[model samples]
Target: MTGTMQLAAEGASDHRGLIIGLFGAFVVATLAITVWAGRQNKDADDYYAGGRSFTGFQNGLAISGDYMSAASFLGIAGAIALYGYDGFLYSIGFLVAWLVALLLVAEPLRNSGRFTMADVLAYRMRQRPVRTAAGTSTIVVSIFYLLAQMVGAGTLVALLLGIDGEAGRRWVVVGVGIVMVLYVTVGGMKGTTWVQMIKAVLLIAGTLLITVLVLNKFGWNISALLGAAAESSGKGTAYLEPGLKYGISDLSKLDFISLAVALVLGTAGLPHILVRFYTVPTAKAARKSVNWAIGIIGAFYLMTIALGFGAAALVGPDRIIASNAAGNTAAPLLAEAVGGGPGSTGGAILLAVISAVAFATILAVVAGLTLASSASFAHDLWANVIRKGKASEKEEVLTAKIAAIAIGAVSIVLGIFADKLNTAALVALAFAVAASANLPTILYSLFWKRFTTSGALWSIYGGLASSVLLVVFSPVLSGSETALFPDSDFAFFPLSNPGLVSIPLGFLLGWLGTVVSKEKADPAKFAEMEVRSLTGAGAH
Candidate 1:
């Protein structure tokens, strides 16, 4: 064979071996854990909340694991590489969201519900409409989030394996779908918890190792590193500050606020994050877990600043930029270059481990999201609506497993269609929707006695509709042009984020609906709702 053909064959062989090995190891490990956990799962509670047996520390780690997804791993690093200090904005926004969760949402949510966030909302309201609305929101948000993650996984796998994009994407979606199904179906909460905990530690350690080495190479001087990054970056010191450049008109201020709002409130409203509160043994444990999660997450974000700048200075933008024209590849490329050349011993090993961890991150997060969506559909919608009362343990668990498979299938389909979008952007949309549709209703339901079922339904529908519509019309959705009227010269919204608009709408709609339906609400239910939300009275 000619030299060119021989080189191509060797490259293809290496790519194929890497993909198969990493993917195979992930599947085997996930399945083993699932089967072991499945044997221990005897009831719905075990399937849903791991029998609420987790200690504060374990649950905290799992929370951090779930929260720090592929978006955090790849997206933040890429953002820093491209945008400098603008990227750290995401870290700050994400970390601040934990404060909202800890001070406002955590303990009350744990005290109120058993499985889904809807359970808490429906406690004092009419069960059918409340459960229906909350379940719809949960499914919508979770699927959107899952689609983003699956897309990221597919793209990463394709890049690493040197395979056709479509085939690689399908493999990622299928791999994650099957693993998540097994995780929720067999191991239930127990298996999911351990998986997330282990993955979190590995992810942190892996990133930290890279950060340490990168710093060591720079002689432990942060200022020197930043100066190098600033000099090398095309944007200069402006990248170190927010809004010095890249402003579309004077709207940079609005865009900054919009992004901040989405990240801050979004975490508290996320179905997967809220459901974690149920995993802790008590309300107090849930609160403590939030505190621990915040600290861990904070440290991780801080490391990303170093890693992103390191990649910016060390790898340089031109070499890492792909034909696709996104910054997400910077982290992986940097790891390969710094650890060693792609085929070098150090580089190859580090890249393999990072790839494995990235794959694991996708699996664990999708599993949690799928589980949350399943529980919301099965328990909140099916059991509450179809059965008209509490479901037997067997029935609830069975329905949940079935729901898991169904949702996973939907995610795969969406991932296939969303190949062109950035996973981080899609995840941000999920956060915006969650913040808009679910957060306000939850907060009011727990703290405001005036809240009624009518109010919740209206708020949920309004927020969901407005947020989705705004996103579809935002610049991110338009692609090459603005969205508002498609043909119109003016874009409807200045910022791509909709949380700033939709979140307030949710609260206003809820308040207005409550006032109009005042006479229909039962005042007696107020006392009960307060007790359940604050002290776990009647939770079982």
Candidate 2:
């Protein structure tokens, strides 16, 4: 911490012009795309599935963008900067999760689904109850993840825009909520996909530029950079080891394993990411999209390692901690340090550009989340359940738009209150819920012939309930100094992430329910679902 570089707390005049110009340009371009895409939606399919017109490459970029939220870009980098090798472990888990998505979920999902994950789950079962369960799981996961993004948005604006008061940060959250609502309600999936594509490319380019600048400062020697990082980190060589973040004790190791499991299995279950498969035309395209997304995501995370270490070596942990207690500001502060220090013209411009890109990152992710929740509301709950499959395409689409506004408003309020939580940890809880609630049900539905409707209900409800209940009682809510309630300790669950227990419980309940219930499986329906899932018989 001795070599820590002081951050310049400059007024708005220093970088406001550049930040506004870049952010405004992105907003205008995305809104224009939304308007154009809105005109192309002639039915519910067009609105939810983007007309199934996107190529593998376009969907690939969008998928990468969707996965790499501010959590991946800023949170992981900051974690690595602060915790060293432990932070890099998250990068490994994130990239490896795509293998689960690509190999296990992508092709089957594309062949089976139309608009939502519920489509796949309810393909063989009695539709109403199954769809209701699916819709509930989808909304729960979406809201948890959405709140994390909203909180990250407010925290990022407060730090980057120099917003000092709580009111200022609250306004930032509201503004982001409005922008995301517009993206989903007007643009639908097509516009959101395009915006994600653009944001991914810019994020990759920005990361590369900062990485090269960091390397140049280190005389293009990686070993020297690592050496410097070790020296700056107070722990010396321990900074290069894995025990810094999660290796404190046996329980922490279990916690680390829980995190990895959630990160890996959760990607396939996430509603927003699962829905993206429907945007492609064929099963083959879906597979290819996943392959492309893995490549892009892999490359970006590799750079995050460099960015994190470079920040530790150059900007030092002390300044990063000072900027934000969670170290979420490390990447932006690194940009300021490498571009020529705070007051220099290069520093101001680069910082502003990166800040704007961060805003775009948040916008694209929240738009995807909002779109997924709205689709669940309209397609599953309203069209299929409430209206008994009699709702028209026009009515369903209108319902989705309205749902987007409601979901966005709720997220803004939660974000304003939850801004103090760590963005990365919040996202990890979201992944845990997705893995526990959605993954087990989908797998059994597609693979097992005896999976009855009762089994589906048990799996979804059991998983969702267990995840939510465990998290509420876990250390994140009220325990220790690091807990949300610093002065209290009511957490009974030792692990913060509930994936290790809940995922197994989800599968076990599905199996137990299937065996105990006398509701015989419909052989004809199972045959139909298997044929369609394997051969894309009825897939559009």
The lDDT leader among the candidates is 2
Query: Model 2 segments beyond 4 Å from truth?
Result: 1-8
Give a tens-digit lDDT track for model 2, residues 1-540.
112222444722476777778889989998998888888888888899999999999999999999999888788888899999998888998899999888888999999989999998888888999999999899889989998888778877676667777898899999999999999999899889989999999999999999899999999999998889888888799999989979999999999999999999999899999999999999999999999999999999999988899989987888887776677778888887788877777876777777778888999999999999999989999999999999999999999999999999999988887765767788888999999989999999999999999999999999999988999889888886556776778789999899999988988989988999999998898899899988999886
- Candidate 1 C-alpha lDDT tens digits along 241-356: 77643353567667767778898999999999999999888888998888889888989999998778987888766554541244565666666657765556566555666767
List the pairs of residues colliding in candidate 1: 38-186
lDDT of model 1 at residue 271?
Answer: 98
Instruction: Provide TM-scores for the models.
Output: 0.93, 0.97
Model 2 TM: 0.97
- Report the Cα lDDT for residue 526, model 2: 85
Cα TM-score of candidate 1 = 0.93
Backbone clashes in model 2, listed as residue pairs = none
